[model samples]
Target: MNKEISIQLSNVSKTFRTSSKSFSTLRDRLINFYKKNEVKTIKALKEINLEIHAGETIGVIGRNGSGKSTLTKIMSGTFIPDRGGQVIKNGTSLLLNLGVGFSHELTARENIYVNGSTLGLRISEIDELFYEILEFSELEDFKDTKIKYFSSGMIQRLSFSIAIFAKADIIFLDEVFAVGDNKFRKKATEALKQNWLKNRTSIIVSHSTGVIKEHCDRTILLHKGELIFFGETEKALAMYEELE
Candidate 1:
C-alpha cells in the first residue's frame, strides 16, 4: 500500500521586499523621506512543488541562500507562500531552529511553561514534563537562569527536548546537529534513531551530507531558490556535491 501524503506544496513561492536606503542620521532620514524608497524584491523561493509522505524522514540540502530554510518554513506554516500557491499539511507540525521559538528575556523554567503551553499542554501537564525537559536538555542547573545568558547549543538542546516530549506529528529540524557539542549531537542522533522519529514524518535541513545520508531515505536538493533535484539520497547528494 502507498504511504499517506503528509504534506503537499503546489506552486509555492516566497518573495521578500527589502529597502536599499540607509539613513546615517536624522538629516539623512529626513532627506530620503520625500524620495521613493528603493525597494528590492528577492525571490526566496520559486514555484516549487513537492509531496512528503507520512512516516518518511526527508533531507534537504543546499548552499547558503538556496531557500532550504524557506521551504521548511512554508511547510510548517511559519511563512506563507506567494499568491496562487497552495500548501496542504495533514498533521500538527513543529519547526525547530536555533532560538526560533524562545523568549530571550524569559528564564529556562519560564520558557518551559510558555513553550509547553503553546504546544497544547496544560499547566498541570507542563509541570509534569518540566523536569523531564530540563533533564533531557542537561540544563537542570540553569533552569532559573535567563535564556539570553545561555549559549546557542544550550538553547537548541532545550528547544529540541521540548519538541520531543510534546510529541509533534511533523518536525522540521533545521541544522539541529550543527551547534551542539559532539556528545550532545551523538546523544540526539541516537535518540532520533531509537525513539523520536519512529512513525513520525520529519524534514531535516542540514549541510552535513553524512547526517542526511544516514537518516534520510530520500532527499531534495535546492539551488538558487529553486528545487533542482529530488530522488534517492545518494543521487541528491551527488547533485549537491557538484553544486558545492
Candidate 2:
C-alpha cells in the first residue's frame, strides 16, 4: 500500500440477502410453513478497484441504484465489502449523508458534541469549534432546539458544518449540494472548495454535472453495480450522459 494513497479498494463487492414468503391466510401460512422461503440476493457493487491519493477531490456519478451510495459507504467504512475483497484506508474518514450519525432527539447543540465525537474529535476540539459550527450552520438561534424539529435543510446544514470542522483526512459526501437553500448551499460549497476539499481526500456523489466539473479533479462513473469509468472529469461526465 502506498502511503500517499488515502483510500484503496480491490476487487470489492457488496450483496444483500432478503427472503419473502406468501401467506394470505392462516391455512396458507400453515401449508407454507414446511416450505423454504424464497430468497433473493441483490448485488449492490461488484469488482470495484480504486485508489485515491491524498488531497484529491473525486466525483462519483450514477443513476438510481447504480451503486454510487454503496461505493461511498464501502469507502467510508460503514458497509463491509463481500469476501475476497479488501478495503484499505490510510487515515481518518467521515461520510456526510442526510441524517446520518445524528440523533434526532438531541438538540442541535448536543448533536454537535455527539457527532463531533463520532468523527473522532475530542471534547476540547469540538468546544473550540462550537461557535464556528453554529455560525456556519446559520442556526445559532436554534442551537438548543431538538433536531427532530428542524427541517431537512437545517439538519443538512448542521451536518455539513460539523463535517468541515471534523478535520478528517478523507471525506465522502452524498448529494450534499441538494441541501439547504441557495444561499446556504453556496456557502457550504465555498467552504468545501476553499478549506476542506483543498487539503483532504474527498469523494463526492452528486447528480449535478456542473459540480463535478467545477470541483472534482477526477470522476468515477458506476452503472449497474459496476465501475464503468474512472478518469478525467469531462470524459467521465460524457460517459455518464451516454449511459442515460
Candidate 3:
C-alpha cells in the first residue's frame, strides 16, 4: 500500500516587518520626524516546496533565525504563508511550543480542556484521557493549581502529557526536549518513542544532531530562510555540520 500525503507545501513563503523607530511619546516622534520610520522586511521562509507522508518522522535543523520555527508554524497553520503560496493539510495537526495555546491564569485541569479543545478533541474525549494525562505528567496533586504558579519544568510536563493524548494526525515539536529536568526528559523521551511518535507523522525541530539521527527517518536543513537540503538523515546532518 502506498503512503498518503499528510502535508504539502507549494511555493510557501513568509515575511515579517520590523520597525526601526522606537518612538514611544509625541516628543520622541517629533524628534525623529526628519528621519524616516525605517521598516525592514525579513523573509522568514523563502519559496519552499515539500511533501510529508503519513507516519513519517522528519527532523528540521537550522541555525537561529534560519526559519525552522517559521516553517513549523506555517505547517501547523499558526502562521500563514505569503500570497501565491498554498499549504495543504490532509489531517488534524498540532504544534507543541512552550506555553503556547495554554492559559496562564487557569488551573492545570482547566488548561487541559483548553488545550484539548484547541487540538480538536471533544470534551468527552478529553474526559476519558484526563487521568492518563495526569498520571503521565505526575502532577495529579497540582491539577488544581493555576498554570502561573507552576515552574517551567512542571508546565512542560503537563504540556507534553496533554500532547501525547491529543491524538493529532500530525504533530510539530519545537525544542520540546529542552524543557524539564534530566529525569523528566528521560521519561518524556521514552513516552515519545513508545507512545506518542509511534506510527505518527511528526516534524521535529531541534539543535541536537543525536535527536535527529535517532528519531527522524529524513532531515531537512535550512539556511537563512532557504531550504538547503532535504534527504537522508546522514547527508542532511553532514550538510548542516559544514555550515558550523
Candidate 4:
C-alpha cells in the first residue's frame, strides 16, 4: 500500500550570514559606522532532500551545532530555505519547541486563546477547552498568571497541552522532554504514545537514544550541519554513538 506524503523537501538548505565586526561602545560603533563589516556565511544545513510519509514518527538526533534545530525549523516553516530549495506540506503544521509561540507578557489564559486560535480553533472552541488545557497542564492555579512568571516546566506543559488539544497535523517536538520534571515527562510520553502517534505525522528531536529507539520507526542522523544518514532507528543510533 502506498502512504501519503506529509512533507517533502527538495534541495533544502539554510545559511546564515554574520558580521565579524563588533562594537562594544559608542566610540567603537561610530568608528565602524562607515566601514563594511566582513560578512561570513555559515551553512547550517547543506542541500538536503527528504520525504516523510503521513502518520510516521521520525526522529532527528545529532550533537550540538549539528543543524538539528535548523532542519526542524525549516520543516515547520519557521525558517525559509535558500533559493532553489523547496518545502511542501500537506497540512497545517506546528513546531513545539521550548515554549516558543507564546507571548510571555500575556496571561496564560490569554495565550491559550491566542494559540488555540492560531491552530484554527474558534473562540468558542477554545473557551470550551480552556479549562481542560489548564487541567491537563496541571496549571489550574496559574491560569490567570502572566506567562513570564511561569517556570519552564509550566510553559512546556501548557504548550504541549495546547498542541495536543488543538490537533495539529504535523508536530515537531524539539527537545521538549528536556524541560519538564520526571512525572510530567512520563505523562507527556504516554500522551504522545496514545494521542499524537496514532494518526499524525511527528518529528521528534531528542538527545536521548532510548527515546528514539522506543518511539521512532526511522531516524535521521545529522553531523556538522549535514544529514549523514536517514534510515533504521538502530542504525542511526549506532552512527550517533560512534560520533559521540
Candidate 5:
C-alpha cells in the first residue's frame, strides 16, 4: 500500500468552534453576550494517519456525522488540518457532500462547464466527455434547464456525471450509487468498475457495506476521529458491522 503514496496524512487533527446559540437575527449578534451558553470546540478529527497509494480503491464508511465528510475534506486539502501535515501528489476531484460546486442561477449545461472547470478540466476535455456524462446522468431533457429547477436526484445525477468525467488522477466520491434511477446506478456501476480496472485511484464514502465488499480491496474505518481499523475489506467490514 505504501509503494507509491499519492496522499499522506500524519497525526492530522481539525477542530471547529461552536456558538452557544444560533444567530438567526442581526440583533442576536449585536447584543448576545451572557445570553449565550458556554462556547465549546468540536474535535472533528484527531491523530489521523493514513497513506493512499496510487491505483487503490478504498472505501470509507461510518455512520452519519461520524466525521466521514470532514475527513474527506481534510484529505482533499480543502480544509486544513489544525495539528498535523499532509502531502498530496496529484490533482484530486471530490464530491464531498450534496449541493457543492453548482450554480443555482445557471443552466445545467452552463454549470457543467463551470463545475468541470472548477475541477481543473479543460473545455476540450469536457467536450470529449460531454455526451458521455449526459448519457450517464440521463438528464439530457434538463441539460438546458436551470439547476434551481432540478430535483435533488437530478442534481446528484449531473454532479456525479461531471465528477466521473473530470479526469483527475484521484477521485473521491461520497454516497455514490444513491442518485438516479436503477438504470443510471447500473450505468454508474459499470463506469466505476472501468475506472478501477484502469488503475485510477479512488476513495468512496458509502453507508452500504455491499459497496465496500464488492468494489474496494481495502477498507479504512474512522470512529469519532480516530483511525480504528485499516485492512482488507472483509475484516474491516466485519468489525464495523459488529459495532452495531
Candidate 6:
C-alpha cells in the first residue's frame, strides 16, 4: 500500500465458476452431474501485484482475451475478485465496452442525457454538455435519429464522447476500435490527449504499440491472465514484443 497508490492489487486473483451443463436439461445434467456438477473455475487474474498513482497514464496492453477487460471490470467495481482483493482509492468510470446503455428506440440526443447521467453526471451538467457531446460525436444531423439508425462506429464515438463529459478521478478506456473513420479517431485521440491526459489517472488497454510508446508512462503486460511485467513503458513493451 504505497501512500500515493490510487489503485492497488496485491496478490489479487479473480476466478469464475462455470457449470458444464449450461442449464440445458435436468436429466442430462443429473446423469453427467455425478462428478460434482462439473463446475470449472476460470482464472481471469492471477497474483496481480501493482499500483497506480495519481497523474499517471498507464497502459495495460496484451493480446485479445488476455484478461484486460476483466481487469477493467474489477477496477470499475462491476466484478469482484474471487481470491485475493483489489482496491480503488478514487472514482473510476470504465468505458470498456461501448453501447452498453443506449436504447435503440431513443434518439442520439436522448441517449446523451440518459447515458451521460448514468456515468454520474448531474442533470444540469448533462444539459450543459449535451451540445458538446453532439459536436464531438460528429452526429449533429443525426441527433434526432434513433440510435438504431447509427452505425457501430457512430455508437462508439458517441459513447466515448459521453464517457469523458463527467469528471472523474480515474478513467479506463478499452481501445479505440470503432471511432467511425480515421479522421474521427484522430480527433478523439487528440481530445483524449488535450483533455483526459491532464490531471487524471487513466488506464488504457490498447493493441497499438505506437500508442503505448507515445502516451503511457508505465505499462503492464498480461499473458493468459497472468501479469508478466510491470515497469517503465519501454521495458514492458519489450517484454510484450518478445512474448508476441
Query: lDDT of all the models against the reference?
Result: 0.87, 0.90, 0.90, 0.89, 0.79, 0.81
**lDDT of each residue in 13-82, candidate 2, tens digit only:** 9998776646556777788998776778999998999999988899999999999999999998989999
lDDT tens digits, residues 125-231, model 3?
Answer: 99999999999899999999999999988888899888877778899999997767888888888888776567889899999999999999889999999999998
Instruction: Give the runs in model 4 whose Cα sits over 4 Å from its true position.
Output: 20-34
* Residue pair clashes in candidate 2: none
The TM-score values for the models, in the order shown, are 0.91, 0.92, 0.90, 0.92, 0.88, 0.90
- Can you tell me which runs of candidate 3 are displaced by over 4 Å? 20-37
**lDDT at position 226, candidate 2:** 97
Model 3, total clashes: 0
List, residue by residue over 106-225, the lDDT tens digit for candidate 5. Answer: 998898899988878899988887888887888888889999999888898888878766667777777776767888788877876786425777888899998888888788887887
lDDT of 2: 0.90
What would the per-residue lDDT of candidate 4 be over residues 1-244, giving only the tens digit for each residue?
A: 2289999999998999876656556787788889766788999999999999999999999999999999999999989999999999999888887688899999999999999899878999998999988888999998999999998878988998887777678889898766578888888888877878767899999999998998998899999888899999999999999997
Give me the displacement of residue 3 in model 6, in angstroms.
6.6
- Listed per candidate, the RMSD to the true structure in angstroms reads 2.5, 3.0, 2.4, 2.4, 2.6, 2.6
What TM-score does structure 6 among the candidates reach? Answer: 0.90
lDDT of 4 at 77: 94
The TM-score measured for candidate 5 stands at: 0.88
Model 1 residue 84 distance off true place after TM-score fit, in angstroms:
0.8
Total clashing pairs in model 2: 0
What order do candidates take by lDDT, descending? 2, 3, 4, 1, 6, 5
Which residue pairs in model 5 clash with each other? none
